[model samples]
Target chain A: MATITYREAVVRALAEEMDRDSDVIFFGEDVGKAGGVFKVTPGLYERFGPARVRDTPISENAIVGAGVGAAVTGLRPVIELMFADFAAVTLDQIVNQAAKMRYMSGGQIKVPLTIRAAQGGGAGFASQHSQCCETWFMHAPGLKVVVPSNPADVLGLLKSAIRDDNPVVFLEHKVQYTEKGEVPDHTEHVVPLGVANIVRRGDAVTIVATQRMIGVAQQAADELSGEGITCEIIDPRTLVPLDMATIIRSVQKTGHLVTVEEAVHAGGWGSEVATRVTDEAIWSLEGPVVRVTLGAGIIPFSEPLEHHLIPHKARVIAAVKRTLAV
Target chain B: MSEPLSAAMRQQMLQRMIEIREIEGRIQELFLENVIRGTTHLCDGQEAVSVGMAAVVDAAHGDTVTCTYRGHGHALALGLTMRSMVAEMMGKVSGCCKGKGGSMHLTDMPNGLIGTFAVVGAGLPVTNGAALTAQTKGTGALALGIFGDGTPNIGAWHEAVNLAAVWKLPSIFLCENNLYGEYSPYADTAPVENVADRACAYGIPGVIVDGQDAEAVYAAVKTAADRARAGDGPTLIEAKTYRYRGHSRTDPAAYRPEGELDAWLQRDPINILAARMIADGQITQAAVDGLKAQAATDAQAAIDWALAQPHPPLDAVHEDIWV
Candidate 1:
């Protein structure tokens, strides 16, 4: 195993996938010579050349729409949308075209495409660029939503997404780019979609989170350990074919649930988890599903307001306390 | 200014236009008679654009075409099985989309017909995407995007064209400028010399054709398709046509002027092509009549097959949501 940052893992995974399959390629704005704004695709252009690693026009619709077309024609294209918020510019292609192609075509066509976008707002990106739009993709059926909290999960899930014969929306929280973790050295570490991992096992409240929120939950869990609140954290690596079974069973055992999401509290990813838990495991719940989410509204440009808008570790801890209080 | 078309291709083109007109006429009758359920956007007068542009498309592997709501003629002309298309309109199990998609949503993937969108300008991005894919994969395929005049103003249209030009994608933007967008007239909707003129803004050649002249459109599209396949980049061709029918089944067309429909009918693409074929002495009247008869029989057979097909099972609604 080697210690690597989430960003490094993503680059490695994309490079390895391109090497493994000639059909696999990466394209997006500044993804070629510049190696992406965050350098997530660093050194790839030189290694793969322009055909496999391309820099596209500053059009989100073209970036994703091109990816969809390429995928349907037998190329596995992984496109970067720079930021998650820009996905709205091409939601029709993503939701209407890519998400519906398989079903609309009666399974005659497959969109073997993956969209990687930098999400979350801890870096003080304003509302237009900083919003965590995970729920938008999760709400969309036929799309596999994957949000890995660590380098290992990111590498594994991306590799799997590239090979899958379906469209996947891989939301990489920008804040997690620098976060380091131990990733397996194996070049073929594949993590299947629709599977969740139990990061920490505890009998107390079950902390269901994804991507950056998983790290925050882990940090909160460590602090809560001294207070005798053993929090069980579950990282739902993939959100669409959600690993609800694992989460439901965990909630049943713990009898308490606290869902964490970086997006706005209103109609966020946490809401889906909360609703599912209520419908499936309501009788097993010791109390209402406590939701630790960002305040409903835009992410402010000001650093302090941005920090205030997103849910912090303290908020996560408080929610865990509230859920376990009964 | 240029010669219209060769006698043989002209007659064939006119037959296609008539086929679309007759099929749409039959569809309207069936819709009112309750034989066909759901809404429809007819292409009665706009037959020339579909037939004219389709005359130039390659339609081979990798080559794709995406149409807008008024897409029946486009689908049929691209060789989509009339039976499956009619079945889809009837919401039957054997429909092109397995009955999930109705008239507005038609998909024929096996024919390299990517799909069409109900939303007016939605197909622009889709076709542009296909062109982008073709360019990246080095397939030498061309994507023909058929949209109405109103779509050029939409954001998707601009984004699609701009991206295509920047990437030098092998795409042809076929704007079927039928002079109206639903209830509103073109003057009220768009303010430009021509929709194709906007293509110059994207650094691509733009041309306008007499939409009522199928040969004129075919010529322009053929040249554009050649340039695209040769890696010269995208082209925008505005086919100036008119719609004889209302925008939808519910529209009575009160927005049209006196004799406007009659004036357009006089310049019908099919009749004009038929006349040219006779004047050029390439084929006898008997041949034109025979093609029309064949098209009618084919259309009737489609209707019969659609009527005999079973309705899609309610369970199948959730099936296409994923591959």
Candidate 2:
């Protein structure tokens, strides 16, 4: 195992995949010589050359539409949208063309396409640049949604997403790019989709989270353990094929559930998790499910306001306390 | 100047156009009879553009064609079985897309008709991607994007054209200027009269052709296809034509002015081809009539076959969502 930053892990996975498969290609705005705006795709253009690593014009719709076209014609294209908030610009390509092509073609084609985008707030990128829109894709059928919290999970999940037969919306939190973790040294390591990682095991209350919220939930778990309130922290890496079984099992054992995410609480992924847990394990639950999320409001550019709006360790702890009190 | 097509190729083009016209006519009849439900965007008069372009590109040789929703002509010209297409419209299990993709979403990848997108200008970038795949994989193939006149003004079209031109990708952007973007007149939406003129902005060759004449479309597309295969980058070919029917099944075409439809009808692609075939001493009026009769018979046989096919099973709905 080798310790690496989340950004480095992303580049490592892409480079390793490109080395392993000639069919894999990468493209996006400033992805070539500039090595991406966030430097997550650094040195890929030099290693893979212009043929595989390309810099596309600033057209999100075309970028994603071209990726779908390339994928159906036998190329695994990893397209970057710079930010997840820009998914709105390419909604037709992602929701209509990429997601529905396979099913529409009667399964004659397989779109092994991966769309990588940085999401979530806390970097003061404001509303238009920072939004966790994974739920929008999760609601759409024929799409796989992956949200990796740490460096290791990012590497593993990205590899799996690249190799998967379906189109995957791989979201990486911008704030987590500098966060470091021990990633598997080997190139072949992959974390399969639809499996939740039990980051911390506890029986007092179950805290289910995704993306950066996993780190927040873990911090809350650490604090809750000292207060004699054990919290089981479950990180559901992929949202579409959610590891609901693991979440339900944890909820059954703990009899209390608190879901956390960086996206707004209204119609967010946390609501789905809460609804599912309540529907299936209502009898086992000793309290109502609490969802710790950003309130229904736009993310401001001010650092203090942004921090206040986004879900943090304090919010997770409060949600846990609220659920525990019930 | 483009080389003249042979007598045999002209006859083949005539037959293909006739087949499309007859098939669409039959579909109109079916729609009127209330046999086939749901919406269908038919290309009754703009047959020459699709047939002419399809004649130049060898789909069996890996060339791909992406077209708009009004793509029955494109599908039929690309050699998709009439039975499968009609069955798809009928929503049968034996349809081309297993009844999943109806008339608007018809697709046949083996014959290289990638997809018929309902969204305007949506397939331009997709076609560019196909061209990119061919270029990257060293496949000697070209992609053709067929859309209406209004699409060129959209962001996807401009982006796709610029990308294809910059990358020097092997592609042909064929715009079938049928004089209307659904209900609106083309002149109102576009700044230039000829859609081909817009290609100058992208630094690619642009040419205008008489879409009513099949030979003209074939020659223009052939030149463009040859240029693409020789790694000369993409070309924009604007086929000036007119659609006989309304945009969709529900349209009454009251938006068209008096004498406009009649003026376009005089330049009908099938009639022009039939007249050309007779004047070239390739066939007599009697033979042309015989061919039309044969096409109608063939279309009827396909309709009968599609009618015999069963509806898709309930379990099949759950299938094809993945893999």
Candidate 3:
């Protein structure tokens, strides 16, 4: 095992994949000589050279559109968008072109493309930048959405994403890039796309969270454990092809659920989880499913206000309590 | 100017143009008879641009082409079988895309026709990527992008051209300046008279050709393709063409001015090519008439074959949603 930060884990996974497959190429704004905006691709440009690791112009649509084209032509392109919010600029390319090409083309083509972007609110980048929009992609068919919480998951899941035959939207929380964890040293260690991880096993209530919210859920579980309220934390590593079996199994044991995320409450990934649990495991629930998320409003620029909008450990604990009361 | 094409090649080009016209005519009849559903963007008068460009690109050598919604001509030019294309338009299981990609989304990957995008200008960046693949893999291939005048105004067009130039990728951007973006005329939409003029901003060679003249288009694309294959970078070629039919099956195209349609109709690509062939003694009028009859028969056979095929199975709808 090797101790590494989330950013280092990303670079390791990309480097390993590129080493393994000659068809694999990486590109984005500043991803070449500058090594990416967050330095997630530190030495890739020098290692792979300009042919494979390229620096692209500030064109989100072209970045994703070209990736789709390259993927169709048998090249595995991993494109970086710098920020998930810019997905709006290239929505037609991502949601329409990249996501629908295989299905629309009657399976004549396989878009083995991975679009990586930094998402979520903790960095205080504000309204335009600080948003977890995985739900937008989760709602889109033909797309696999993944958001990893730790360095280990990042390494394993990223490798699987690059090898998968479909297009994957890999969301990395900007706040968690510096978070460190133990990652396996083996190159063959790969986490499949649809599996969920049970971080804490308890019987009181089930708390499902993703990305930065996973840490908050873990912290909340620890605090609740001191109060004699045991909580189970489930990190649904992938949103699409969701590991509903795990979440349902946990809810069956706990008899309550609280879903947390960094996106706004309405039409959020949490809402989908809450509905799925209530739809399939209502008989096993002892109380109504509670969702811990930012209220319906844009992320503000003020540091305190931004902090309030993002779901923290306190809000998760409050949601766990509310679920217990129900 | 003397024609750069041989007699046999000229006859072949004329035959291909006739085939496209006949196929589109059959589609129109089918639509009227309620046999085909959904809207179609027919390339009635833009056959020269598609056939001329396709004549030069060697698909077997890894050359690829991407086109916009009005892409049936390009599809046929790029060697997509008539049966598969017609089956797709009819939503049959035997379609090239297995009925999933209807008329506007025809794709024949094995023949190097990457895809026909429904969105305007969506093919530009994709073609750029295909060129990048050819360059990186040392495939000695090039990618061609066929779009309308409206596409050059989009941001992707600019980005794609700039990227291709910077990378010195083997790509050719062919703009079919049909003088209209749906209902809006080119003059009303773009500030520049010629779309090729915009290519100067990217430091690439830009050429304008008579869209109705197949020989002219063939020569221009040949030069550009040669430059690309030699690693001389990308080129932008604007074929000043016209679309005889409406933007879609439903449009009346009443927005066109008086005599504009008449003036363009006089310079029809099929007629121009036929006249040249006869004047040059390459092919007699009787031979040209025989070719036209053959094309009509072939188009009818495709339509009949597609009609005989069954719809895709219910479970097939769920299939192909992934790899």
Candidate 4:
């Protein structure tokens, strides 16, 4: 095992995969020579050279559309959108082209493309750069959405996302990049899509979270353990092909659920999780399914307001208590 | 007919053009009969540009073309069989995309027709992407995009063209100046007189040709394709053309000037090519009539075959979302 920051794990995944397959190509604005604005892709251009790792102009449509075109033309392209919010500018390319091309071609074409973007609301970069837009991709049919919370999950899941046949949107939480964790030493390590990871096993209440919310729920579970109230935390690694079987089984055991996410409460992914669990395992629930979200609003620019909008351990603890009260 | 097209090349281009016209005519009949529901975009008068492109490129070497939603002509010109074309419009499981892609989204990559985008100027960047593949592999293949005169006003066109120029990808953007973009005339949408003039901003050569003359379009495309193959980067070519029909099946095109359609018809691509061939003694009037008859027969036969095929399975909607 090796201890590394979440940011380094992303760079390692790119290097390892590009080395494994010659078809894997990475390109984005300031990715090469600039090492990306977030400083995640420093040595890639020097190692893979300019042809494989390129620096493109500020053209989001070209970045994604060309990636789809290249993918169908026989290249596994890994494109970067810089910010998750920037996906709005290239919605037609991401939703209409990449998601529909394979199905539109009736299996004649396959878009083995991975789009990686940084998301979340911790650094107080304001509205344009700090929104959780994973729900938009989750709304698309042919896309696979991955939101990993740790270094090991980032490395393993990112490798699987790049190798996946369909278009995968890997949204890396900005706050978690500096966090440290132990990753497996095996170079071949990869976490498959559609599998939920149980961060902590318990029998009291099931807390289903995504991205940064996993860490929040974990802290709350640790504090609740002292009061003899243990909770099971499930991080749904991928949202589209969600591991509902694990979630349903856990809900059956715990008899309760509290879905958490940093995104707006309106049409958020938490509602999707809550809807599925209530429909499939209504008898297993002893209480009403609860959702903990950032109520329909924007991510503020101030640090204090941003933290206020983001769900903290106290909020998760309160949500757990609320679910038990029901 | 012209100095560039040899006897065999002229014959091939004429046959493909006639096939496109007849297939589009049949599509109209089927739409009226409620045999093919929804909407259909026809490319009757703009056949020369699409068919002219097929006369120059070698699809066997991975050369591909991306065209707009009015793409029946492009599908036929790029070597997609009339049976597949008819089957696709009929929504049969035996179609090119297994009835998944209708008339507006014809896609058959093996035959080099990569895609027919329903949205305007949506495929230009895709062409650059395909060109990027050609350049990286050192293959002398070209990726051509066929859009309309008004596409230059969109963000996608500028972004795609700029990226192609900066990367020097082997790409070509062909603007089939069909006089209008949907309901709006090009004059209303674009500030420029010719779409090719916009290419100057990208530091590439811009050429304009008669869209009604097959040989003229062929020569212009050959020049651009050669330049791309030689690593000179992308070129923009505006083919002056007009569509005989409205944008889709819904409108009667009452917006056109009273004599505009008649004037454009006087220089029909089929008649222009046929008249030139006859004057040059390359093809006789009787031979032209015979070719026309054979094209009609082939189109009718394809329609019959397409009618016999079954609709896609009910559960097919869930398939093809993944590999």
Worst 10 residues of 4 chain B by lDDT: B1-10
| Each prediction's RMSD to truth | 1.9, 1.2, 1.1, 1.1
**What DockQ results do all the predictions give, each relative to the true complex?**
0.60, 0.81, 0.79, 0.85
- Which regions in candidate 4 have their CA more than 4 angstroms from the true location? none
iRMS (Å) per candidate: 1.7, 0.8, 0.9, 0.7
Cα lDDT of model 3 by residue, A99-132, tens digit: 8888888998899999999998867798999888
| Cα TM-score of candidate 2 | 0.98
Clash pairs of candidate 4? none
Q: CA lDDT of each candidate?
A: 0.85, 0.91, 0.91, 0.91
Model 3 interface RMSD, one decimal: 0.9
Candidate 3: misplaced stretches above 4 Å?
none
**What is the TM-score (0 to 1) of candidate 3?**
0.98
lDDT of 1 by residue, A105-202 (tens): 77777999999999888886788988888789877788988888899999999999999888999989898899899988889899998899999999
> Which residue pairs in model 2 clash with each other?
none
| Residue runs of model 1 more than 4 Å from their true location after superposition | B1-8
Span of ten consecutive residues with least summed lDDT in model 1 chain B:
B1-10
DockQ rank, highest first? 4, 2, 3, 1
